[model samples]
Target: MVERMKTYKAIKYTLFVCCYLFWVASAVLIAVGVYAKIAKEGDVVDSLTADPALLLISTGSLMFIITFFGCFGALRNGVPLLKLFLGILVAILLMQIAAAVLGFLFSDLVLERTEQLMAKGIARYREDLDLENLIDFVQKKFQCCGVHTYKDWSGNVYFKCSETNPSLEGCGVPFSCCIQWKNESVLNTMCGYETQTLEERIAKDSIHTTGCLDKIVRWGKRNLILVGGMTVGLLGLEIFMICLAAAQISRIRGKVKTVNSRRRAR
Candidate 1:
């Protein structure tokens, strides 16, 4: 009986420690997100649809609430709280599986929606600093230009190729699209200037004329194994946590039953 009790205590504390660590992490995420929102309030409002800080805050808040239930339930051996936590975990797992299946079955639709979002982002490129930086980073990393092609920059007001466009950046892509030079110490922000006016064959030599979406798709395919492994690892960890909580609940109930029976006998 003492051995069984010891085992129960071990499981309980282990679960507590795991939940506690996640709770701390969630708190930190929330803090950083709040700080970002406050520091760049103007920028965040402008990019409301694509604000990274808002994403962080929402994700962190959900994690914080879930981990709180896990921690409190484990420490107090509260059956209801533990059951709630287990149910939430199961629901999340199901949602993830459903999303993955839907994404696979409707890949074309997914791509189309992604393209639309990317186009919107491009259109508002100059309106949001965060979005601008994000687009530039992706372009440089993938060595690609606009959504479908370099010419797609025409969607942006400042980059429109119309003769009436007065902006100096008119008909030009961002510097990120430029072909980086070897051993270059400084970036030539104007390297992409007026490149859109050139023929495709000629422009390819100076800047990346390929679409970013194609490059991203190819990159994903090449790293499929890594992505799949990470997904599987996360699912396995969640399953393990669910099992631990279930076992602890059973132990608590069994102990309660034993105590009640002994009291009735007396």
Candidate 2:
């Protein structure tokens, strides 16, 4: 009985610690997300499809609620709450597996959808500061320009190549597409100016002519092992948590049975 009690306490405390850590992480995410939302409130664009703050908040909120149940259920030995938490975790695991399978089987569809989203982002490039920064980061990191080609920036109103366009940035890609000079002390933000109007061979000397999608695909292939390892690690942790909760539930039920039998004997 003493050994059983020790094991029960060990599992209960371990589960509580895990849940508490996750709860704190969720709170941090929520706070950062809220701050971002407030900072960008004045320049609110149609960011429903690509807003980083919304994504952070939604993910953090879900995690916060789920971990709350896990923490309280473990600390109080509440069977119903533990069962609810276990059920949600199992459901989330199944959804993740299903998403992975679907992504693999419909890779072409996924790529097409990704391309469409990238194009939308490009069109709204200047409308959202956060999105603009994100695009610039991707372009600089990948050493690539537009979604499919440098010319794709023509879809954006500010960068469109037209005789009547009054925007000074007209017919030019963002500075991110420019090739960085060796030991350059200052950035030439106008380096991409009129590059879109130049011949491809000539423009290649000034800015990256390759598209971002291809670059990203190659990058993903190169880091497949790292990405796969992280995915597996996350799934494994969820499975372990589920098992721990189940074990604690069983221990609690056994203790209750022991108490009932002792009362009957007395």
Candidate 3:
């Protein structure tokens, strides 16, 4: 019985820690949500200009941070406040999962739509258009859209843009093919093209953050899948902790009552 009580105590404290973690995850998710909200405000992510990689990265990072805490919520802590916090964390994690699913599923849809629009844009920009310049334009636009490789920044990769501007112009035109991060800049792959005119356009295409999500997306679905898988696992742990916490509370109450009754009888 003592052993059993010890186990229960262990589980109870575990729950508390888990709940605390979930509270943390909830806090991260909330922070990410706030950042994304600010970044994506107004026009939001539209069909024509959305950046899949950026979306995935920003959202995934948020999930990753929050889910870290979420996993702890699965322990056996017997605190109502912690439970409440766990619930919030779980809910936020769920929303993030939903967002990821939406981002993943609709990604191809947006891709198809945007590609079609690019084709149209290409067709429309003909006549006075520069075919050479168009290649430059396409390359630049794609690079700006978070659609390139990591080594591409090192100027070593065989990117689509490289074929067009084989000369020094294409080799060093970082802004010619990269996204601009607001209030944040990096020395490596980023192009600092701060456009006030693109404020609306920026609001439409990219997930808002002081960081870049492009790094993950250019490689395909792996990052998002990893993040989603992590979120699901963390969420499961949180649920377990919450349930355990509840059980511990009941047991603790029962033990308290028994001890008090015996003392009164004595």
What CA root-mean-square deviation does each model show from the true structure? 2.0, 1.6, 13.5
The alpha-carbon deviation from the true structure for residue 9 of candidate 2, after best TM-score superposition, in angstroms, is 1.9
TM-score of 1: 0.91
lDDT of each: 0.90, 0.92, 0.47
What residue runs in model 1 are displaced by over 4 Å at the alpha carbon?
41-49
Which candidate order results from sorting by lDDT in descending order? 2, 1, 3
Per-residue CA lDDT of model 2 for 1-266, tens digit only, reads 78998999999999999999999999999998788888884555646577777777888999999999999999999999999999999999999999999999999999999999899989988877778888999999999999988999999999999999999999999999999989988989999998899988999999999999989998889999988999999999999999999999999999999999999999
lDDT of 3: 0.47
Under the 3 Å rule for N, CA and C atoms, how many clashes does model 1 have? 0
Question: Residue 223 of model 2: what lDDT?
Answer: 100
The C-alpha TM-scores of every prediction are: 0.91, 0.94, 0.38
Which residue pairs does candidate 1 place in steric collision? none
Which candidate should be chosen as best, given TM-score against the real structure?
2
Encode model 3's per-residue lDDT on 1-266: one tens digit a residue. Answer: 79978977776677656545545665665565455445542433333223332444466565555444434433433345445545665676578679778867898786666555444333322122222244335454444422332222223221223545453423232243444456655533433222212343452343221211243345346566776677779777756755665666566667788899999999
Q: Any idea what lDDT model 2 has?
A: 0.92
Candidate 3, residue 14: Cα displacement in angstroms equals 1.6
Clashing residue pairs in all predictions, respectively, total 0, 0, 12
Question: Ten-residue segment with the worst summed lDDT in candidate 3?
Answer: 123-132
Model 2 spans > 4 angstroms off: 41-43
Residue 157's lDDT in candidate 1: 94
Q: What alpha-carbon RMSD in Å does predicted model 1 have with respect to the real structure?
A: 2.0
